[model samples]
Target: WLVKKTPDRYEVKIPARIFHEYVAFMRARINKGMGVAEDAIWSAATECLFLTSSARTKKDIEDNIEREVIGKTIGKFRNKYRSALRYGILDSAPDIDVLLLAKEIDAAVVANDFGIQKWAEELGVRFVPAKTFPLMLKEYLKQRSSISHSTKSDFFDDFEES
Candidate 1:
């Protein structure tokens, strides 16, 4: 319905490592006595995040002053690429491909990672908060429904007043 209804182009991009992290997170919780709601969240994420790798990872970040402050103040982001290397977020870290895709496409990313969002902003990209997505979507649909029903509702209101 979303793809069909939206009049604009929809493109998908992902960090291979982040994608893997989400996938692994979902898989680990499966059949572990998760309740109905948890299962639904897990299922929704698992189903939606499934992707076929179309490109390899690539990034192009230069160390600078703001990056230093941002890294220290907000959250764990400054050394995200480095930490990815140490923690093996992917088989390798610093997947420039993820950030490069954001830069090249000039699109907003949906993510929970402050690192990805901050760097994306620095690179002239946008990021949508992961938790806020459902609320946004719900409000959008609600508005659409209201508009769709308003014509009939207005006619009925006029008749009732008469």
Candidate 2:
């Protein structure tokens, strides 16, 4: 759900759900003409790590149970609670995983889900919209490439001068 660039490579940290939905994630980028983002994700995948937390799983189960029980009983207030409480809330295990991991590693979350975005803001985690992720990656790569090329050219020029 998010990527962090280290000196050597990009580190993509995702939950099991994202890992399972990997194809769909890439397809979405491809559909949006974001081949660069897709490529970036693929390249990061080589160094990616899939992680899960028992605490997150327990919280997910408890939340689900509470929601199910409350959902059935709150006939009159159902609409109100549904709109206010559930509208922009983390509802899945993957959601929790993304937030927790991003917080732990101090990485920006890349997701379009409103729930995830809302929670990221509440948790003070940085967020990158999925739509613009490719653009950002492309710019970064271009800058790095240019810098490398210029450095090489400068080295060669110095050698020739010498």
Candidate 3:
């Protein structure tokens, strides 16, 4: 598969728990009749690179659940969320993993995760806003185009792509 073989294009990272959560979310979305290209999801997971924060990150995610639901009247989803937040299982994060991925890889994060976007600014990570991607995409594409401008030695530096 392209993802497994070549991670250069779509580098991604996630807390171990959040990774599983993404799987469950994907499952629920499909079950609930949300339409998505399966290949895209699979690529985002299997092909994209992944990472995790400390264990406290998982606890941070669990602690936020009640307040999160209180806002949404998310009645039945509570326990499911805790279980999902259990480390290395679901989309739990002290901060969202997608944002962490953006920070780690310096890649333009393709997500509408406002939570992550908020933290990303604080962390000084650049994010490609999901909803406004088309408007920003010309710049994003321009960045991509310059990828090859870096010679092999320069591309491998520790400073990150940006």
Candidate 4:
């Protein structure tokens, strides 16, 4: 079976948190002289869109506290157990940023955070496990290299015949 080629326009959207995590992981691999890590880093540099979400403003802090404390308290009294339980699932500003950026760009999220994965699914965003990202990048780069090599060989063959 033939596999479809990845589109040239395909882009990877990454939040700052994931970007840092990926960079650190790749750096370690690169220091060890892993060829796949080299390819992955190059791909990330070219295809990944690194984005930073806004900082948690005063209002956001207040809202979080309200949700964690007052909301949970009210939820328990009102028999809304699920709402109370949801308070800490997305515990940080960076987590929310990942969801927001993915939703805005209609891109898949690569993150290990279970909370992010759960919420991404709820928002109809695609999710890719962080663990497999490097492997995927390696495969993509291999395919790209093979295609380029074949194209170059075919060009040389045509030139020789002419």
Residue-pair clashes per candidate, as listed?
4, 0, 10, 0
lDDT of 4 by residue, 1-162 (tens): 999887663365556677446545644543455345444544443332222224344333334544565544454544443344334356455677787799889999998877788888887899999999999989999999999999999999999999
Q: Which candidate number maximizes lDDT?
A: 2
TM-score, prediction 4 = 0.45
Worst 10 residues of 4 by lDDT: 45-54
Arranged by TM-score, best first: 2, 4, 1, 3
Q: Ten residues in a row with the worst lDDT in model 2?
A: 45-54
* Winner on TM-score (1 vs 4): 4
lDDT score, candidate 3, position 131: 79
Instruction: Give me the runs in candidate 3 sitting further than 4 Å from their true place.
Output: 1-95, 138-162
Q: What is the C-alpha RMSD of each candidate to the true structure, in Å?
A: 22.6, 22.8, 22.6, 23.9
> Residue 157 of model 1: what lDDT?
96
lDDT of 3 at 138: 81
Q: How do the residues 1-162 of candidate 1 rate in per-residue lDDT, one tens digit apiece?
A: 455565443355555567556545543443232344444544443333333222232122223432463334324432453354324221213434566676678767776666666666766777788899889889999999999799889999999999
Instruction: Return the TM-score for each candidate structure.
Output: 0.35, 0.48, 0.29, 0.45
The pairs that clash in candidate 2 are none
Higher-ranked by TM-score: 3 or 4: 4
Tens digit per residue, CA lDDT, model 3, 30-100: 43432233334433433222223233433343335434633233333444554454433223344456655
